[model samples]
Target chain A: AQRVTQPEKLLSVFKGAPVELKCNYSYSGSPELFWYVQYSRQRLQLLLRHISRESIKGFTADLNKGETSFHLKKPFAQEEDSAMYYCALAFTGGGNKLTFGTGTQLKVEL
Target chain B: SAVISQKPSRDICQRGTSLTIQCQVDSQVTMMFWYRQQPGQSLTLIATANQGSEATYESGFVIDKFPISRPNLTFSTLTVSNMSPEDSSIYLCSVEDQTGGDEQFFGPGTRLTVL
Candidate 1:
């Protein structure tokens, strides 16, 4: 069975500071990792994907196959970046369901 | 990428009553999925809605309790029967489009509160 693990529940940082939300997964197949973000009172949206290798809102995640990790990082955080971030893994199991990790709530203070 | 929409953005219902949530996709999709999410928690896959066929539900979920229908590639619905307080959660519908990748686009979601 495939599973996603997000070690942090809450991460607090100041505006313009660097932020990293840790994520790890357990899967034997080639994993397709993604990051989704949900702002207050808004719908959830895709932030980025490992396959795209592009950054959104200055956030990027690198899939480290050997480490079994895909950590989301932003060099300079903004107040608008405060939101709930989810790490999801899509694999060929359970009818290709996207297994999501318990999200990490980020609070960017000024 | 695909765009998805869900109706009844939120509702408060009494116990034993049922609510049906609707999902619509902008373009034809290959697979539609339903998921449950508690506040401040992760998403749990409820079922896979296949066009012209009965939905395939995951463990801990059944058709009798959560009936699903996918009449076409662009639309699906989920009905939650005999609701209880435990059923109060956000239900989301997603799609796997022919965008040349396995990325899934999600709807805004329907928030149900059973009392």
Candidate 2:
């Protein structure tokens, strides 16, 4: 079965601190990974994807095929960065449905 | 990224009633999806609302219970029929916008509460 897992349900850190949200997956074939974020009272939005190899709001994720992981990391957390973050995986064979992890609530305090 | 909108941002409904959620996109998208986000759970794809074709439901979802309609390239609707308390959750519509690898854009979501 293909599944995405976010080990931590909640993560808290002070502003300017380094932050890391771990995400792992179990799949049989090549998987495309992405990170989605939902701010308070806001819609779920795509933050970054492994394929893009680009950083957004100082966040970056790397696809580790051997480890089956795509962890999101930020060098300096901001108070405005507090939100719910989800890890998603797209199976190439299906109708392009996205499988999502349970999600992690990040709270960056001042 | 494409802008998406959903109607009835939040509603409280009685059990055994039904509610229809609407989704509209700013541009014509190739893929439209309906999702359920129950309290304390991740978003689950209920069905794929393909324009001009019957929806493709997920394993645990059915067309009879959750009827979907896609009338055009940029609009779709999902109706939750015979609702119960279990049906109370946040419903979201999404579209995949990508050149190769898929990245999804989502609506603000409709929050349904059953009593």
Candidate 3:
């Protein structure tokens, strides 16, 4: 079974401070991890994927295979960064099914 | 990325009634998915909807409770049957665009409140 765990349900950070949202996964094969963000009044959207090896909106996540973690981090948090963040694992199969973690609500306080 | 849209952005429904949510993609997609997010919770995948076959439901979600239809590649519908207050949730539809690397783009979810 594939599982993703997000330990924190709510994480508060001050604006201009660094922030990190933890995520860990359990999978048998090479894991494909993703970070999806849902801002207030907006639909859920993909922030980044491990396979891309790119950053979006000043956020970057390094897929640590040894740690089995893909923690989303930003050097300086902004008020606009406040949103619900979800970490997901895409299984290696035909259907392309995804197993998601319990989301972390990021509150970037001004 | 794909442009995905869902109907009835929000609805208040009475118990025992059913609501059918429709998902439309701007471009044709081979794979579509349905998910549920309860109040103060994360996303839970309900089922996988393909273009030309019966939907594949995940554990704890049955076809009788959540009947899905994917008659074509660009469109699909999910009907929540026999609703209850516990069923109040935001249901989301997502698609995998082959061109858009492994990321599943999501729709503006339908918020359903069962009373």
RMSD of candidates 1 onward, in order:
1.5, 1.4, 1.2
lDDT digits (tens) for residues B24-112 of candidate 1: 99899888999999876799999999888889988899999999999998999999999999999999998876574766788999999
DockQ per model, Cα: 0.68, 0.77, 0.79
CA lDDT scores, all candidates in order: 0.92, 0.92, 0.93
Which residue runs does candidate 1 get wrong by more than 4 Å? A94-96
Interface RMSD of every predicted model, in angstroms: 1.5, 1.3, 1.2
Report lDDT (Cα) of residue A67, candidate 2. 89
Listed per prediction, chain B TM-scores read: 0.97, 0.96, 0.98
Candidate 3 ranges beyond 4 A from true positions: none
Residue A40, model 1: lDDT of 96
lDDT of 2 by residue, A1-110 (tens): 78999999999999999999999999887888889999998889889888789999999999988889999999999999999999998876445689999999999999
Error of 3 at A37 (Å): 0.6
Task: Supply candidate 2's per-residue lDDT for B14.
Answer: 93
lDDT-better candidate, 2 vs 3:
3
**Candidate 1 to native Cα RMSD, angstroms:** 1.5
Q: Give lDDT tens digits, candidate 2, residues B29-62.
A: 8899999999999999899998899999988999
